[model samples]
Target: MEKFVRVKGVAAPLPLANVDTDMIIPARYMKALTRTGLGRHLFQELRFDDADRERASFVLNRPACRDARILVADRNFGCGSSREHAVWALTDFGIRCVIAPSFGDIFSGNARKNGLLLIRLSETLCDHLRREIALAQHAAIEVDLAAQRIRLASGETIAFDVDTDDRHILMEGLDDITRTLRHADAIARFEAAIESLMTIP
Candidate 1:
């Protein structure tokens, strides 16, 4: 997992709502447990046609959005199945932050654990950002996690709320395992104390 203190980069607009995990990476590409190489399969169905050729109509296929690191999507983004692969695919595609009106519960957890910042804002704000990205070629969005705000190209700033623990996890680049390891000494002491108590009894 990578630290996500701040991100200022091209934002791709995904206007469709109810985007599920399957649509993100598709179930066929979920064979790999590792997070690497999923970028190629991200949005496989939308990015490529049945013939496996790039679809020109897709937003991600557009030249301006090719290297987009921020994704501004519609409501109910990352809905459906609880597969963690969805988060893996997005991060692997170089997307560091996802801005939407709402997200699936499981998907949200997966994203946070993997160091992907998921910002929930009002529907109106989401629409504004999406439209802004579509109209401006090579437009960029700045997300400052420490500040809990998004800076748009029009010089407007929108505030968003994130769980405090999630914010800390992303800022510090700590995954679940790493987070647990942070208390290694305390855990070891507790285990040793319990063992000693049992032996005395």
Candidate 2:
């Protein structure tokens, strides 16, 4: 897991609302059984036409929005089936952080577990940021997990709310497994004691 302290990169605007997991990566592509390669199918439906031709109008397909690390989206982002692949696709595509007014509960959990920062901010503020990025190519957006704030190059900051424990996880690049490993010595000692007790009369 990579520590998400302060990420400054291209801010892609995904202005649509109710962007569910299936839309992020179609369920058909979910058969891969591995995290790698999903980036190629991220937003498969929107990125291409029915005939499999590229759609130039989609936000992510735009030349300037490619390789965007931060996504400014509308309400209810990540809304459908809780596919972990959705998180994989976004992260694989270089999107380290996502800013939206609301997010699906399951998808949000999966994202945090995978080391992606999901930010919740006012819808108005999110819109402002989205538009700002579209107006400028690779417009820089800074997300500081320790500070719980997202700032644009212009110096405007939007404070977001995140649980203390989750915030700590992002700052230290700790997933659930990593968090448990933090107490490895204690766990080993307890196991050793249990083994000795079982062997005694």
Candidate 3:
């Protein structure tokens, strides 16, 4: 997983609440075995129409937000299902972070494991951010994980909070395997002791 130290890019405004996993990436697109290539199908239903044409009304399809790396969303984002694919789709689509009032329990876990930063803020603060981003000349903002703050293009700053463990995981880019490997020496010592005891018999 890539380390998420800081991200600066257009912050897309997704004001809708209760965006589910199926909406992020429909199950039809989950047939593939690998995580790659799912980016194209991210927000499949909302981004494309019944005929598979791009929806002009979708925020992601708009020119300013087409390459957005950060998303400012409403409450209860990622509310349905426990699919990790939703997190995959977002990361694959180049979204490194999502700012919402709250997230689904399962979806939050998937996001952390997958290296996507989810920031929880008050509804009023998120609304303020969305408004600022929309009015900015380029709709770009910067999020610094080290400092736990957001800097808008207008030179204003806002503080945010993240769990210490979550921050460490992202900053160190430590996946589960990598994290486990950090205890390699201890694990090896324990195994060696067990082997010695078995040989004593």
Model 1 lDDT tens row, 20-107: 9999989999999799999999999999999999999998899888999999888999999899999999999999999989999999
Global lDDT of each model?
A: 0.91, 0.88, 0.93
Instruction: Report the lDDT tens digits of candidate 3 across residue range 1-201.
Output: 899999999999999999988988898889888899999999998999999999999999998888989999999999887788899999999999999999999999889899999999999999999989878945679999999999999999999999999999999899899999999999999999999999995
Q: List TM-score per model, in order.
A: 0.95, 0.92, 0.97
In angstroms, how far off is 88's CA in candidate 1? 0.3
Model 3 ranges with Cα > 4 A deviation: none
Task: Flag the better candidate by TM-score, 1 or 3.
Answer: 3
Tens-place lDDT digits, model 2, residues 52-124 = 8889998888888787898889999999897999999999888999989999999999988999999898899
- C-alpha lDDT of candidate 1 relative to the true structure: 0.91
Displacement of residue 101 (Cα, Å) in model 2 is 0.8
The most accurate candidate by lDDT is: 3
Ten-residue region with minimum lDDT total, candidate 1: 130-139
Q: Evaluate residue 156 in candidate 1 and report its C-alpha lDDT on the 0 to 100 scale.
A: 80
Top-down lDDT ranking: 3, 1, 2
Q: What is the lDDT of residue 142 in candidate 2?
A: 87
Clashing pairs in 1: none
**Model 1: how far residue 58 lies from native, Å:** 0.4
Which is superior by lDDT, 1 or 2? 1
